[model samples]
Target: MTRHPGTNRTAQCVVCGRAFPLPKLRKIGQLRPGLHEMIAAEVADCGAESLICDEDLAHYRRRYVEKLLAEERGELSELDRQVLDSFEKGVSTVQSSAASVLDRNPTFGERTADRVASFGGSWTFILFFMGVLFAWMALNVSGLFAVPFDPYPFILLNLVLSCLAALQAPVIMMSQRRQEEKDRRRAENDYMINLRAELEIRQLHEKIDHQMAHQWERLAELQQIQIDLLERRGDTQRG
Candidate 1:
């Protein structure tokens, strides 16, 4: 109950047992019921009239959110942990650039596979490969080559096509695997951003509700004081 010099009034925090100015203290009653329950679960002696400093209140708010998330999800994943950490730190969960996530300094082989897969899927590669096949057949069948390297059956050409297919399949698969990994990371990032936004909105709603409740209480007190003053005036006039 010791007052800070020059301050009108001060209240001591029940959790931390540190005195703070009235403006810096929050009543347990003003908190949302869920948040109050969280604090009470930790501090057995806390009640509706108990005061908590803003810092302790913030800590309990974070714990309440963490408990809510854990209850809803059961087991927290790495992504969920990251979201909670960011929420506690009051930092943004949004990635600065999504491309940075996709481009995270890929290895030489990965880059090459991606490029090969991309080219192989394009019309340019298809048309060019078709033209090469036609020219090889024309050269062998039209007697353009003195002794055809690949004869009418074109066994050598068949071998080359088979080799190309074998090499291309695995490369495309590797590229696809890398793409799937990138997509998974992007999804995690999106989820974290969305979760952060939702937490912020919930906090905002809690603050508005707290303010409204506090205002109503102040108004009720003022009305009671006015009624008391009017009663005193009536008694005085009657006298």
Candidate 2:
């Protein structure tokens, strides 16, 4: 059982098969992912793995856990949502829609990388650079229909092109850097989604095991009761 340090609301976190919230603890839950950005700069002064695990998993199971996590991480699509809604037979239905999202949830980095890559190799970038090069080369070179607006390999033109490239390259690099940052953030969201899913999955497994254990315990208890009843009957008969 994973206990929440310095607390009483023992984690019934059936996911990792741990009980928690014992004492001397703090909980960092009841928060939305939108609020997570502000948290990026907040540092935990001194804490061990157990406390980290407790807080991380607690938020994983709070209200709207699956939906909020999936939506924020860009894992849930409209199509998925439609299918999920249809699965419900009533206005109030079981949480089976995402019952397995966490169980089958993928790693954040992996999923986000796949999505970003799907945008197709920043080819717009390559095309833009190529267009600039071709235009520069053509305007200054003698060729079809062009006596060369600036004459073959114009020195002044080349210098101008060089200057433009120098300026443009840095801007392009800056744009690329910003793009990379976006990818990194998306990847982080995916990771958190994956983490929450894995934790929830572990809890589900724990729930199953707990139920099975209790079933066996209850069987034993009932058997004892039956035996006692039979012995009492026999004693009365003998009496």
Candidate 3:
């Protein structure tokens, strides 16, 4: 509901670059350089970057940073050292917070069972088998409504049915095997995402541990220096 650049403006997602008609989760977005300036310049006498939606911000960030930028650094004013330092600190803090969240987070993979289920359902498969059986029975039975389409006892009908099943079974099996392969691929992608997340978490903890160890080492060094200085002063006074 709240607006940013204009009275009725919707913010584009900094992460995904898609615009929202209504305000979205603000924490997910960041201001890309020149985004506002280009929006202001839109449809002028010259070319300008078009406004985008929040849903697309990530894609834009990945694909169109250069095209949108009017200059090498993306047509933005040079950031002062203080601004840069503050930005870096903010980023580090956000990353640390994300790491903390990820450490405690549980990840469950998106289910690939839907694809497997799509191969066919048990009900449908059974229905198909029932249809085949009913057709065979009707053709063999001599009745007023029945035609001799399959003839008496339906020997030829059974032979044809057997041949059809023999052919179709292998194809259905192939389809199922292909589905299994796709499921394996999906599982692998899930594994990779999980692996990357774990690595990122591990790296964060290692960094924090290293910083703590470094601080301890520095404290120890300072204590040793103080002791040395005190001993030197005492020796001079004694002499």
Candidate 4:
């Protein structure tokens, strides 16, 4: 937040030609005292004395990032393209949970199957059904009804059990199939997330490398500037 002295308090941007507050404009000198000269000489051609507005600065930053990525990856993937696009557009790359989105719109059959599978797999169902079977046997064998509805071998009970089994097996299988599908989708989402994260990390490394190289170059230039200044002082003092 360095303040620059100006009567009008406005500076015209070299790139866009728009007037912005002197404090708001990023002076070419302020970017990097040494590297700015190289950038102005090599890339921007602005002669080391220029001002850029926030918009143009952002544009240059994005271009720098893209250049680094291009040099590293050689070609952009769709995912890489999307990530760079998001950076340029100032949009967030993070996404909502895919599992939540998938769960939000379940069909009636899916819901029913899940519920049936959960209930059928529980100990409560097992214990209650066992109790019912015991009661049926007791009532028939004790002759509580004068004539047993299911005689000794319990043929009627066997038919009921067979029908229940026939129905429950399919419901559990349907639920398991839906679960497998969900797991597959979740794995795909996880892979995508991990890939995106790796790309971002790689891009970040590129940025850091670019900055380190730029800083090293800048340091060399600063040392040269200091040497020239000392030489000039020595000559002036001798005179």
Candidate 5:
């Protein structure tokens, strides 16, 4: 191929056999160097020394990810399915606020039940109720009323107390049920977040392992090259 004298460095893509600017191509030395040899001749006809375009790189990346998934999880779980889908789509995996999930709009009854439960379980409510009971008994005993509306047995007070207990019990129970639901939702959210984090960490480990292996191979190649050069130098000096 002919090129302008001022044209920047170009690379011949091994897959398409087309020349592109260096910026548009990735060096085999930088990527998985082993991949250059594994590449099918039909798709990429190149020797050991080759470069790949962005399109070919993406294809190989997808293949690598699939291989990892198949090896790690024989049968995909729900979390695994989600992670693989996100990986394929190149989507971000992040955790949203689990605590804030309770912010959903609640019905009037739910709100009222929560408030009533909270108040009924407080010391202020108990103190106020005790004071009212004491005042009622004092008034009846002192004969404050012309006929002491509620006499010694205070049957009216007993009836009022029973009615209050019946109503408060259900309200408190309703509030507790709602709280249990929220806790369950939070637990589910936390589990998803933790599972995703674990998957991402595993993915990172795979990438790092691949990179380290490649680096070791490259270092060995470099060391061999240096040894060959030194031998040649000694030969020349002896002559």
Candidate 6:
């Protein structure tokens, strides 16, 4: 209700008791009843004429969201905390890219594993290895050299294949583990985005409802004023 001594352009915030431009302040009467009650619970002396700055209103809005989340979920996860923090900070919860969640500087071993996994799963690797196997068997069985290095049964080739399988299995597994981590991070990012959107929608509904209620109150006041004016005119005529 209070303003700066020399200017009517500013109003005092009930919560902070600081003067702010009227455009930056909101009257308590215009707020949704639930939010108004929340403010009243905290600020005992605040009334319909009290004004709250945008910053204070946003703080209360955050608290209201937190309360709603707590009532529904009982306990908040790290993801929820992250979403709430970003909401309060007025920042987007989205990542720049899906891969942005991955470590920027992967270790040499991890990089090598990923490369090996990528190549091993490709059709080129399968066809190239098939040709190599055919050539090795043909050279050994057809006596192409004086004494084939791999001989008839190709024991050396078997050993080579065994070692490749052993090494490739672990490398592919490492790569898969990294991929699983990336998927988990992507899921978390999605969850945060959805939660923020839901909260924003809820806030929008609250604002719309409050606006409609305020309009109704204004219409009612106008009707009452018209009735009083008509009563006064009738009385004056009778007199």
Best by lDDT: 6
User: How many pairs of residues collide in model 6?
Assistant: 0
Which digits, one per residue and each the tens of the lDDT, describe model 4 over residues 130-230?
Answer: 99999999999997898899989999999999999999999999999988978876765665566556656765776577668778989999999999999
lDDT of each residue in 110-195, candidate 3, tens digit only: 12333334444578767887898886777568474546666676788779879977865665666566557656655544544453
For model 3, the stretches where C-alpha displacement exceeds 4 angstroms are 1-121, 145-147, 224-239
Return the TM-score for each candidate structure. Answer: 0.81, 0.41, 0.39, 0.61, 0.65, 0.87
lDDT of 3 at 73: 45
Question: What ordering of candidates by TM-score runs from best to worst?
Answer: 6, 1, 5, 4, 2, 3
Name the candidate that leads on TM-score: 6
Which lDDT tens digits does candidate 6 get at residues 1-239?
45655656777899999988888998887888888899999996799988999889888877878888999999889888778877877888884344465747888998998999999999999999999999999999897799889897889999999999998999999999998989888888889999999988988899998889888989999999999999999999999
What is candidate 1's lDDT per residue for 1-239, written digit by digit as tens? 32345655876788988878888887897788888888888886788888888778767777788888889889778777778777766677874345586767998999999999999999999999999999999999998778999998999999999999999999999999989988887887888899888988988898898889889999999999999999999999999
Model 2 residue 145 CA deviation (Å) reads 14
Q: List the candidate 1 regions with Cα displacement exceeding 4 Å.
A: 1-30, 44-58, 95-103
Clashes of each: 0, 20, 13, 0, 0, 0
Point out the worst 10-residue segment of candidate 5 by lDDT: 33-42
- Poorest 10 consecutive residues of model 3 by lDDT? 79-88
lDDT of each: 0.85, 0.50, 0.48, 0.74, 0.72, 0.87
Which 10 residues in a row give candidate 2 its minimum summed lDDT? 86-95
Native-to-model Cα distance after best TM-score fit, residue 135 in candidate 3, in Å? 5.0
Stretch of 10 with least lDDT, candidate 1: 1-10
The TM-score of candidate 3 is 0.39
Task: Name the better of 3 and 4 by TM-score.
Answer: 4
Candidate 3, residue 65: lDDT: 35
Tell me the lDDT of model 5 at 170: 98
